[model samples]
Target: MIDLHLIGIGTGNPDHLTGEARRAITQADLILVPHKPGKSDLADLRTRIIAEVCDDALIALFDMPVRDDTLPYLTRVDAWHDEIARIWAATMAAHPEAQKIALLVWGDPSLYDSTLRIAARLDPAPRLHVVAGITSIQALTAAHAIPLNTLNAPVTISTGRRLRDHGWPDGCETLVVMLDADCTFQSLDGDGFDIWWGAYLGMPEQILEAGRLSDASVRIIARRAEARAAHGWIMDTYLLRRRA
Candidate 1:
């Protein structure tokens, strides 16, 4: 059985790696990295992490398959996960002697990441171990120098899809949004709201914007578009708070 380690590397920054994450990488018999065609930089970042932390470790690379968009949402995701699991299995099979494998995850694996769910589908599933690292929300709040919660008020954490489908969550003074590809904040009324946004957090190319929602919404949308175009990919998260 494989001893799988899902180590959170925290937004592609070396400083974000913990001692536990370093140990997991060094101790692993194999490290698998996923590559996307146009997003080679992401794969490069993981490679760089390995080079810096564990240069002597054996590395394997696999191409990540794109999800089929034609199917219904949940169905599409389930099928995609199955495909990823298959790819993972095939990769692991190639190194039959390697009993310990590690995959570096961006941010904490438990938050807005599907790695854990995909691992569950592995046949003769590996023994799972998770090493937590700083989440994008933590990076966002830290970059903005703001408190995530306001004086005992509850904070609602959600994805951009939910923010678009359900509008602002009820009973929460602060909302932290993640995995927002569409800049969903533009869909909401911007009055009396403050937004703290960050893109490519913890990386050298990191960008941050914050101000009244009314003032920052359009700028964030334009900036995000330009950045995505330039880099061919982008990962961003933000915090929105309603004025008292």
Candidate 2:
């Protein structure tokens, strides 16, 4: 039986790893790092994180399966996840002696990540353990030096696709957007809102911009594009709130 640990490594920062994350990494028999095409930096970061906390660690570097965009969104994601599960099982089979396996997730697994869901698909399901880490939202807020919410007001976390399709969620003046490749803020009127945006948070390549949404959108778009070109990939998030 495999004891699978879903460890959150935090938003691309080795120092963001908690003591529990370190313990999990050190105890793991094998750690899996999936490298996507044109995104080698992502896999390299995971490898570096493992090396930082564990000596002579057993790591499996595998190519990530590409999602079929031609299929509908939900179906595409479901099938893609299934393919990942198959790969994980095969990888484990190759390392029969490794009963304690770990996956280094980006940010907290409970927040907008699919590692847990994919893990669940393993045959004869393995025992699961979770190690929480700092999230991108926290990184963004800390980078901007702003409170997540004003007073007792609530904050809503959403994806860029949702924000673009549905506009702002009802009853939420403060919205944090993730997984947006295109700057969807341009779709918003942005009259009374302020935006705090950060890219590659907690890393040396980190960039932060905060101002009225109307004024900041242009700068954000330009900078985000330039950074993406420079690094070949970017993970960013933004918090938008109506100015009180």
Candidate 3:
């Protein structure tokens, strides 16, 4: 069986890598790196991190398949994952001598990433090993210097689409949203909620804005657009809480 190591490299910083993640990378026979065509910065960052932390492994870089945005959202993502799986299989097939393969996952694989799902599609599925890294949620909380929850209250993690599609969730006063292409907070009408929003968390170009949603929503949207244009790619997450 192939040995698969899903190592979380943390957010965007090379130093965010844990000792365990470093060991996993160095121990692997081969490490597969995905190269997103238009998002070359992200690809470069991942490659740099691997280079800094893993000195002994053979690194194989492969082009990432573009997800077809024309198809309906879910269907499009499904097709994209299929394409990625095919590429991954081919890559591994070419390197049969690689008994242990490592994938440097951004943040934890257990989060919103689909690397785990794609791994399942392998013909002879590898024995999976996971080393958890700092998630965006952790980075957000740490950057904001605030606890994720208040007085034993619940915190719900969601996506921007969910927030727009289904207003607010029931029974949860605190919400953390990720994978938001649009500023969905504007859709929420920005009432009494306080927001702690951050862009490029844990990176050198990190930007943060926090205040009443009503006060900060517009600025966050404008700043996010400017930064995305400047960097060509942006990954951001925010926390919203209805003041208790």
Candidate 4:
């Protein structure tokens, strides 16, 4: 059985990598890197991170499988995940002597990431160890220098799709949204909340905006658009607190 290490490398900044993450990389016999057609930069970022910890690391790069857009979202994602697991299994099978294979996950794998889910599809599931790294929420809160919740109130985390489909979560005063490519907040009657949004949270080109949603929505929408156009892609998260 192979030993699989899913190491979270944090948002965009390499500094967000924890000591455990570094050690996991250094000890990994093979590191799997994914390459997407338009996202060469992401692959490069992972390569750079691996280089920092293990200059001589054995890195195997694989082209990422594209999800079928024609199929329903959930079904498409499921099939796509199956393809990825197959590729990962095939890749590891090639370097059978490697024994310990590591994949650098962005942010904590336990969060909204699908690495853990994909891993479950592997045949004879490998011994999995998760190395936690800074999450976008943590980075967003840190960049804004604000507490995540108000006065011990509970915090709710959801995706942009959920927020857009279901409206605000019931009984949630503070909400954090992730994986939202569209400015779904624009669809909300945002007058009663304050938003703290950040893109590229720990990176040098990071952008942050915070204010009452009524005022900041437009600004964030424009800024996010500009950043995405400039960088070709953007990973961001935001926290919204209902104004009391």
Error of 2 at 24 (Å): 0.6
Per-prediction TM-score: 0.98, 0.98, 0.97, 0.98
Q: In model 2, where is the ten-residue run with the lowest total lDDT?
A: 184-193
Error of 2 at 161 (Å): 0.5
Cα lDDT for residue 37, candidate 1: 88
Worst 10 residues of 4 by lDDT: 182-191
Range of the 10 consecutive residues with the lowest summed lDDT in candidate 1: 166-175
Model 1, 149-220: lDDT tens digits are: 988678899999999998888777899999889889988778879999999999999999999999999899
Give the Å shift of residue 123 in candidate 2: 0.5
The alpha-carbon RMSD values of the candidates against the true structure, listed in the order shown, are 0.7, 0.8, 1.1, 0.8
The list of candidate 1 runs beyond 4 A from truth reads none
Q: Which one is best on lDDT?
A: 1
Better of 1 and 4 by lDDT: 1
lDDT of each: 0.94, 0.93, 0.90, 0.93
For model 2, residues 1-244, the per-residue Cα lDDT tens digits are 8999999988988899999999999999999889999999899999999999997999998889999999999999999999999999999999999999999999999999999999999997999999998999999998888899988888899999998899889888899999999799999877778999999999989999989998999999999999999999999999999877
Candidate 2 global CA lDDT score:
0.93
How many clashing pairs does model 3 include? 0
Model 3 global lDDT (CA atoms, 0 to 1): 0.90
With a 3 Å backbone cut-off (N, CA, C), the pairs that clash in candidate 1 are none
